[model samples]
Target: MATTDDSFNGLTEYCEDCDLETLHEVSVQIRTESTKEENAQFSREPYRVCECQRCGNRSSQRMNNA
Candidate 1:
């Protein structure tokens, strides 16, 4: 499974207020079970949440199915 930091690498740019102009080096893990309706194929994946280091801006990026 990919960690939040892994997803942060996918970030192409920083926010307007970002001073460092780079993604933070923090990892946040969130785990939950999905209902049948949510994942009909029973596919489980990790969702990444990232935050900016300077401006405290937050964003999320989902991993690709590949």
Candidate 2:
């Protein structure tokens, strides 16, 4: 349940500095784009707020759990 470095592990992605596409640190996030039903329920689309752990460059993507 715990990691030594406490760094969040994630899928591979392009990092300008890494070039090898290293891991990213997913941090706090915000959401938008609610569906009609979800809007009524006050739901919001998920988005990941991440940064390249190796370079600190930031990026974002839809938080698709699947």
TM-score of each: 0.42, 0.44
Question: What is candidate 2's lDDT per residue for 1-66, written digit by digit as tens?
Answer: 112333356355667777766676666565655657646455555686767777788877777654
Candidate 1 local lDDT, 1-66, one digit each (tens): 222444536443456666444655445554444667667446555556767765788766656445
TM-score for candidate 1, residues paired by index: 0.42
Candidate 1's C-alpha runs over 4 A off are: 1-13, 17-20, 28-43
Q: In model 1, what lDDT does residue 2 have?
A: 22
List lDDT for all candidates, in order: 0.55, 0.62
How many clashes in each structure?
A: 0, 0
